[model samples]
Target: MPLPSIDWTAQQKAARQRSIAGGGKPGLTRMEQLAGKSGREVLEGMMSGELPYPPMNETMNMWLLGVDIGRAIFQGIPLPQHYNPLGTVHGGWFATLLDSALGCAVQSTLPAGRSYTTAELHVNIVRPASHRTGPLRAIGTVIHGGRQLATAEARVEDEKGQLYAHATATCFVFDVPMA
Candidate 1:
């Protein structure tokens, strides 16, 4: 299979920015020493060029935990209000985040004229996600590329690299002939 050409749409990025910015701020902060780039710029670099990490990488979420990437790092924190009536973080939260990460990883490496859908998904929830588990990170990678079907692997782990959950999926590719 040919290497994927990445293109993160402007509209998709704008929406993310709006979510982050929330309501309009009263004003701007003093240059903030290190002026940050818009999510779109960072994504553009990834799409047309390169980023320091994989797509769907939300290291920026670290602000919530007051941590930095690769330093005293915890894992992605459990989402708030993500609890089920059973008094535990809902499995759906894990599934949603995993699905997002998995799908985005594929999208990040996909070529135009082609699209993908989950043909099969198997998530093994070894441990429950706890709001107190510090932070968590879900990493996804491709395991196989086929003419009509592709396979991928994903893991949701805590800061200490302890696996909380693991999943493997088969993605159906369509609308484009294999090149």
Candidate 2:
């Protein structure tokens, strides 16, 4: 198998451009502002593109599609780009999607200045996925949220609702100082 072609010049330029652009919503500088809004509001901003979607979403071809207080849903397609050496969608891609959903589900429950990071993640792949799986959805819901920690669960499934993978995550909650 040959390595994918690369245009280092173009790739470098694109990387530079992305950095200067600031990955999230423009002109929103205060992390406290996020803590001030309900989880729904923040998720809404991401979905509406009022907030710039994370660059990773573009790289993975996945994006936040829906959210509520303690739940989030993401959609993606399994493309050749995600293929593993075995020619199936890599387990890491499934884990990434589930992690995003799980983390965001906890994020949706946070207050403006508050944030959480994945302290631990556990994923179980029940069925292999590939480009042939068509489009898929990852749905996450918060199982518990406390002052210092949050736990969420998520599952990845095809359009017809066949389960491919599922996961749970623990996040360490913290407050960021406002400037």
Candidate 3:
């Protein structure tokens, strides 16, 4: 069955407005400012504009929406630039969205002075997406957070809750180096 129509332009506009209201802009937080802040706190800072959002988000047409203790939510707008030669959204786009959500989900669980990097990632694309797919959301939740490793899973769905892709990631957790 066809998914219900969505006013994606309005949705994107609303999201951008919220980001702007919160002080969000594409940039990176300085390590000095990040020192002693927990992962969740850092994410909160980015959301509220106390810290700069990642520049990659602008390039990919995606941004973080929210974060919790061990979960992260992100939204993306697929455009022609993201399409593969086959005339649909490229799998790399799906993987990038999922990776961001999954990595942030794991990061959300880390304590101050700790960080993580994805050691392995597995993505499963269940449905094809295109520019017409509208705004899709990726919700990521931590499966496990340990001293040395963390695992997370994420799913990408449209506004109507139709799944397009799902992914899992294992991240290597380590202490952040102080300079």
- Would you list the C-alpha lDDT of every candidate in the order shown? 0.50, 0.76, 0.87
Top TM-score hit: 3
TM-score of structure candidate 2: 0.80
Give one digit per residue, the lDDT tens place, for model 1 in 59-132: 22321111111111112456456678877777776765566456445544554455568888888888886677
> Per-residue lDDT of 1-179 in model 2, one digit per residue for the tens?
11124442333334334434544443443464465676667767666544556767767767676678889877677789999999998988998999999998998898776778999999999998887777677889999999999999999977566899999999999986666
Superposition error at 137 for model 1 (Å): 0.6
> What C-alpha lDDT does candidate 3 achieve relative to the native structure?
0.87
Leading candidate by lDDT: 3
Give the clashing residue pairs of candidate 1, or none: 75-135, 75-136, 76-135, 76-136
Q: After superposition, how far is residue 100 of candidate 2 from its true place, in Å?
A: 0.7
Question: Which lDDT tens digits does candidate 3 get at residues 1-179?
Answer: 12225575565566566767877778777899799999999988887777888888877898777789899988899999999999999999999999999999999998999999999999999999888888898899999999999999999998778999999999999999988
At residue 34, candidate 2 shows an lDDT of 65
Better of 2 and 3 by TM-score: 3
| Cα shift from native, residue 43, model 1 (Å) | 6.6
Count of backbone clashes for each model? 4, 6, 0
